[model samples]
Target: MKKFYYTLLALFFMLPACTKTDIVPFTPETDNQLLEYKIVNVQGSPIYGAINQQDSSITVYLPFYLQLITLEPEMKVSDGATVTPVSGTMIEDLLDLFHKGREIKYNVKGKDGKVKTYTLHVQVQQPDLILQEVSTDADNPNTYSLNMNLDFDSFSFGLDGAGFAADLDMIRVMLVDEQNKEYGPLNISTFNTTDLTRLDFTVIRYKEQSDPILAMLPAEGLYRIRVYSYAKVATTKNPIRINLLNKK
Candidate 1:
């Protein structure tokens, strides 16, 4: 009877050992987030996307000419995370029908099967007023001659927008001093469309009719030229700085 009791006790201990439970290890989720986004240039270089962490938004600037076309920008994500809208190193048709701004949605799935959605805002760089020539008035020291070209015409802004076909009134030249002080937002009253790629026009600067800020312009100094579009309410690209003619 004692041997039988010992055997029963031994069987009970063995049964507990056989029923032991295995503890599964715990895993913490790592932040596998998207980092940079970029537009591809002509040279096949990746133009990184700009991330605004404050607003949880991304912005990518394309070439002025390509702004109106569709775009597929590339993205860089965190380790082990995959992003949607993937393409052949470039996202295609990402910015179709570019107005002022376009929004792109991205879905990022991490290795842990968690997903995050991101909004990417895309914009085109401002068109510039390309300087063609600068001439000086032989008769007056304060008077100057400027022959400039508008980088883009009416079609470039938009064909269906309200600003279309209003090329002459759409643009104004903003002059600033070396210190970035505002001088004048001069109007380009007339344009010659002899050149399709650009608009050619001449500007005559007279001290008497010029803005009061022009009076502060030094005889010879550095100044910046900004071409603003009234319709778009934005400045064009390539704000150029030039040295004033040393009229002694």
Candidate 2:
């Protein structure tokens, strides 16, 4: 009788570890619960192209162009469950910010009154450059155009600031048009005298698909303007600039 009891106990313990699906959990009573979640040790941005799935908490690198995302499995939710305010983030910072060597905790609770909140943390560091697209002519005060030029800062060219400027590899630019279509597949590798980051998106303004500057739209809409590799941060002072010229 004693041997049988021991075997049954071991099976009970193993069953949960084997059968339970590993995923973020969800609840019905609180939107604030999910909002409190956070990440650590990631160097990217708030509009991250997608998400990183690991055994631990998701990593969110600030100012990079990445965002945190989570999907929970439902056992009790019927007819499909939904989470409101699905994603949240912190003040955009430009650096490798570790979560103070601690995990961030959220207060997630389900309709059944079960709490699923968790904690996260990350390591931080300073980035090399700033990624931005401020108007070259501030007086214009217009959103970027499909046909535009990057207006970089004064330090932008030559062997003085950094060696990489002379041997730069790529300049990637992308934009989605008003018709829910991506107008570019544009990529630039040439630097005029100033190494002023330039991406020719003039063809895209007419809603045409161009390569090296890839874009895809849902319909017809100018929903996004993206520039990368100019720096690590989503918003920066130099490295790149967007001069929305007069509808070229």
Q: How many steric overlaps does candidate 2 have?
A: 51
- Candidate 2 TM-score, true structure as reference: 0.25
Candidates' RMSD to native = 14.3, 18.9
Off by over 4 Å in 1: 1-30, 65-68, 87-96, 100-102, 128-248
What lDDT does each candidate get? 0.49, 0.34
Residue pairs in collision within model 1: 37-49, 38-47, 38-49, 71-94, 72-91, 72-92, 126-237, 127-237
- For model 2, what is the alpha-carbon lDDT of residue 200? 32
**TM-score for model 1?**
0.37
